[model samples]
Target chain A: MNDAQAPIVPAVEVLAFDIFGTVVDWHGSIVRELGRRYPQVDGDAFALAWRAGYKPAMVRVMSGELGWTLIDDLHRMILDAILPQFGLERLGEEERRELNRVWHRLDPWPDAVAGLQRLKRKYLLCTLSNGNLGLLTRMAKRAGLPWDCVLSAEVFRAYKPDPATYLGVARVFDVPPDRVMLVAAHHDDLAAARACGLRTAYVVRPLEFGPAHPKDVAPQAGNDLHSRDLLHLADLLDC
Target chain B: MNDAQAPIVPAVEVLAFDIFGTVVDWHGSIVRELGRRYPQVDGDAFALAWRAGYKPAMVRVMSGELGWTLIDDLHRMILDAILPQFGLERLGEEERRELNRVWHRLDPWPDAVAGLQRLKRKYLLCTLSNGNLGLLTRMAKRAGLPWDCVLSAEVFRAYKPDPATYLGVARVFDVPPDRVMLVAAHHDDLAAARACGLRTAYVVRPLEFGPAHPKDVAPQAGNDLHSRDLLHLADLLDC
Candidate 1:
């Protein structure tokens, strides 16, 4: 999209990304691991079902209906419920806990490392994911994701779509809202960020839901830039 | 010092450094700027007095005698109080605020960038300074001090020498206290970390004060390693 046609916002200073679908291939990573652990289970279905549980779990916590729960805990809760449904059994508690931690070892997209490096040179880059701090820190180290800082919902005690999370990034860097941008695969996340007077970048992850599941193809206007991947976003941002 | 004679502690996994006097020469930066701004003022004395206000200001916040205040705010308060003592005329509020923020722009020691780069490869290196998030983030970007994360007492809502501040690093990285090492020039800061079960490394910064002002030359026990500079520490750590 042309810069003029895009939402006219101040030049972005910090770019905060949504981790699971946007930067890392969560579905593919989970499916691969599921295939290895449960040979009889439909790995793709199990991966999608596990992710489908993510939002509702977060919503329970965000609405005060449930007490504050870290993403690591939420992931484990989902894992337990799904294991029986998938006909998986006999795994020890310690092994099951380690398996649940597979999210922390998710692989980055092919262009993620190069794109982040380019963007980091010009703009302050950080993670604004629902992932907990410990999980995100370990993932960055394992995946070699270079970030100026790793910020999470864990730090703000609030999840995404909450104004507090977006505003927290601004407060952390001591910058104005317009100077910080939220980059995500989900249009809803970008919309929330734009509503809060922050810039937005939409990165399309067509395979995020696996080959059987269709991606969101509808066009959006709130996004300051829309691209196929992080590298394209970097090019459009002139980083 | 030889490793054999060093205090027995688990080998340091992460080295958290005290920034002002340890990684960066705050005295030199402040004194040089002072001389440039006010030729008539005693720059050396002014720098010493400004730094002297730091600990007392932090103590008030730590003791709960004063409300929680960040290092940036504390520096501004001290600046306002001391400006008149130096026989300086009233400056605009904006100018005074800008002057106080000079701490955020302090230059790193010559060996700092290179030493941190070497150490980062073998260890998880971070800042455990009294400086707030905004200050440390800007300083890292400005000085190219490679850090895995920029941590501060701000995260703990308590200043250094407090057990919470020392233990907070261990909590953040999910590592045992003994694996996290405190690297600093001051005996008191190192002592506090050691008391809290963290390893300690003392890096002597003889010129941290100007030539006229002498620093403590005596080495103390409870320090796991003592080095002349960051590069020397890099050698001892076998980085």
Candidate 2:
């Protein structure tokens, strides 16, 4: 296939990643960590329920109902609310803090490290995530994600799907939005980036939610590129 | 010789770097690049004069005399101010802009890559630089800097030596200030970081300026650690 850098497309100077499910296997990593720590609990259910609370928590911040909260604090808020329901309330504060850091230790999808290296050679690569700088930095350290830089909504004090968050990547690199392609698994994230004039690359993470949660595999319209995974995106970009 | 983690000191969780003279040989690199591009001009004088304008320009942003400006822009501002003094006023806008990007391609000091890799094993290594995110990211790409995150004064809209910039590293990692150490060649930078309760590691950069600029070779008071270079710091930290 012709690379995304073919003459027909606008030249992209930077490739910003959405992170979480898009780059790291968040659900699997969470479930595995939870299961390992709490063998008695249904880790799958806990992981899903915890993740389910993420956006709504951000909405509170985004809508001005809640003051600005770091992902670490927000993740703890959800974890605390759901722990008792799962009978894991017996965990001590230190243990809860340790568990909350599981997000900081997520395993990269098998392709992520290698794929990013390839893409990074040709284009500037960075994280354009809702994750806080601390969380993203720790995750990159633990997972060996070779990002040129780790950028976050915490820097902009805005959440993903917010135009500022999408456009902020462009701002950081001082590139036009069209010269920055957001590569992500989520349609909404790509849509937001596109709305803000960024080129979008949609990659399918079929098991992003594990087997129980069926995800859309179809490529969305208006995306500049689509791929099976980051390696494929690397191939498509001739990286 | 124990790792910096020895019982005598606070357990530093993050090692934030001061780039430019500390990590990259800015004087040598800038002089070399400038000399390569403009053999007719005195690159040494140009380089020193360029740097000489840096702090005063930053003072504008820091004191609200001017709004927040990225170092790249400020560097250009300095470059333009000194161009006429060097009889290089005829340099076009595009050439001046291209030349301004020389800051982004600084060559790392010999031990930086290996030392940083070692430090990364034990500490969350990051760039706590006044350079804008774009410049830092590009420098990392060019120099193989293994920063876990590239943070900037731009993120806080405050320049270094400010309380906000020092405390901001700890805030990013959600660690105590003492758990974050500022590693730099500049006593003033380390002094400010220490005042904010951050641990400090002062590394000597003997030739940060060309032979003409005799820098202070003695260690300053208040720094928690002293090293000949990053490799020595890595050894001291037991990384």
Candidate 3:
């Protein structure tokens, strides 16, 4: 690796994680659930379509078109809109509510639990997800993700890519932004956290979307560390 | 026990804890630490004075006399004020800072960890304390308190006895108020949660102010459950 690409070790006291794609297999979890419920449907396409609606829904709330809404509500709205398109509009309110909660039941990446246990010995670990606190709490309990704290956009009343969410983690811990590192699978999240003066570590989740549509795992220029997965990130951090 | 004194079981989905004197032994912990540092001083009196400053400090913030300040700052303010009276004003900045963090290092009650582990299997566990998120998180990490969520008055911008802090627990989980139980040693905290339509569990912490001053452990009229300690609460909850 070139000098610019080498990992820059700073004085990091906290690690804030991006939950959905970085720590958990959201798309794969959704696809598996959908396949179980409706074997005839194209589960992959449905999973992708549901996730595709996430950003725009968040944009509406961020732009104040809708009053502050939790990710659970946003997921339900998206699920309701896409169910008819997938010819599954017959699902009842209870079914839809249960289906919408698939986000809470997303399976963690294989390295996530063990890697977190290792890194948690050295630094504070928290979720910096757009997911609501309840959702994050349930997910952590179910997945055995040993987070020192669970923070959400619901807490800051702002979503990721917004500076408040990234900066809020540091403020909660009473630490400078540079002492907190944002660990994620997405470059956009790392960039936003970096913009807020936080250190950044990118862990590539190649199958974030699924096997058919692999996410780009290329190392971005400004991130302090880049690794194949969470375990690799732990190794790089000397955990 | 009479009808009013008997445990009234409810479908509580979450157990919201009052951290300081409930799950942890703040007075005992503070006195022990203070005794170790200032061997010639009256550590019990010093500890009580420090804790006595807590509610009034929170009242200042709650009454809008002060801006939204964290408990950590309040502790520091109280520490600085009481140091002179205790003949410990000779301590420097770094020593003072470390001393102020005694709250973060307070040990849990003997049954706190095991009782919480059992209750956690049956219900979601969270802290609903006036303590700041950082303090609670650090305390949990140090004392091995397994909270699914670390909530604080800082999150609600209001301290205990505020309806916002009580109802906020239910709102976070998208559950009705009764599904969230406030488990506290203080009657006022439990009463506030009850007034907000939440279930209330009162745990007795008789030595909260140290062995010289035992707190009243009489069962209140309104609490749905009363127990000698957290382990008893776990048994009452059928956990």
Candidate 4:
């Protein structure tokens, strides 16, 4: 679905990536963490169930059906509901809270660190995630994700696919919309970015959802560039 | 006023530095940038004149006489006034805007980067600058500042010396006031931080205002730690 032959416009100055699946191995990390913490629990099922609650919880905040809430808060809300579903009734409040923060300690894909380091040497690289500043900052520190800055939907008080979040990065840098690029594994995010006159790069993360679930295997891209991973993206950009 | 025998408390978990002269050599940077742009202009005098307007502009914002403005805006205001004062009227509006952002491209002190890197391995290091997030983020990228996160008074909509600004960093990291240390070269800034239940580190920047302006040489011990530079502070902390 990509237009490889289309004339590529060279406009983007900052390349912002979606954090969860685009940069890190969220499902793998969550399952690994769950297995380590609760050996008897169905780690794979728990990971999938935990992630299932994410989109709905964010919808609550995005629709203003709930007050402005951070991703950390959203994660905690989802964690509380899933705890009983997994039959983990004995987990104390402190343990539950710490476990919810496993999102903050999510492991980076092997290429993520080296690719980002290389990209950072040239362009301004940051996380334009739906995550909150506190969550993003802690994640970067814990996982050694060297972000130039962490720009988020929390900064704009709106979630992704929202034009405000896409344009806010450009506005913060005092650059034109076309001078910013959204690099994500999801086509919807790229479409939203393209709608805002920003460039887009599609990164394929086949295992983002784990072995039980399949990501879109086809090279479906509405973006300016499609690459295998961050390193390939960096190479494509000649960085 | 030096207290060599005072019982020392444990070092703070986060050491947030005031950036203007604490982390970066602002005077040197501004003077060099001004000299590069206008060879005929007396860069030293021009820098001093530009800096002189800073406090008054901040006062207007602080007094609520003016709406809350970012330091980037305040810097531009000073730049506009001082550009004519220095008799350099050749710069266009775009040039002036870009030049005003030399604040965001200021060079870090020789010890600043190394010290920050060392401290980051042990404690969370952030900028509690009066400069806005955009300015701070750009500066960090340009100067290779390894801040785990960058916190600014702009985040709190309050300028430094305001208790809210000092306390904001602690609140952001979910840490107590006592666990956050304000590291600055300015005595007034350190005093304000100490008043707000934060520990303080005094790093002397003798040439911060050039040879004409002298820094406080005597160790007043008003702060918890007094060091010659960031490296010395790192040594004291055993980082």
Question: For this target, which candidate reaches the highest TM-score against the unseen true structure?
Answer: 2
Per-residue lDDT of candidate 2, residues A1-239 (tens digit): 55744553458999999998999988999889988888888888988999999999999999999999999999999999999999998999999999999999999999999999998898889999999999998889888899998989999989999999888888888888899999999998899889999998998999999879879889878998888898898888876
**1 or 4, greater by TM-score:** 4
Quality of model 1 by C-alpha lDDT: 0.85
What tens digits encode model 3's per-residue C-alpha lDDT throughout B1-239?
A: 12343346557899999998999999889888988887888989999999999999999998999999999999999999999998999999999999999999999999999999999998999999999999999999999999999999988988888999999999999899999999999998898899999999899999988999998899989989888888888888777
- Please rank every candidate by lDDT, starting with the best: 3, 2, 1, 4
Interface RMSD of each: 1.6, 0.6, 0.6, 1.3
Which residue pairs does candidate 4 place in steric collision? Answer: none
Where model 1 places Cα greater than 4 Å from the true spot, the runs are: A1-7, A35-41, B1-11
- By DockQ, the best candidate is 2
Q: lDDT values of the candidates?
A: 0.85, 0.90, 0.91, 0.85
lDDT of 2 by residue, B56-105 (tens): 99998888988888999999999898999988899999999999999999
Candidate 2 wrongly placed segments (more than 4 Å): A1-10, B1-7
Give the higher-DockQ candidate: 1 or 3.
3
Could you tell me the lDDT of residue B21 within candidate 3? 91
| Model 4 accuracy (lDDT, Cα) | 0.85
What TM-score would chain B receive for each of the candidates shown? Answer: 0.95, 0.96, 0.96, 0.95
Model 3 TM: 0.96
Colliding residue pairs in candidate 1: none
- Give lDDT: candidate 3, residue B65: 96
Worst 10 residues of 2 chain B by lDDT: B1-10
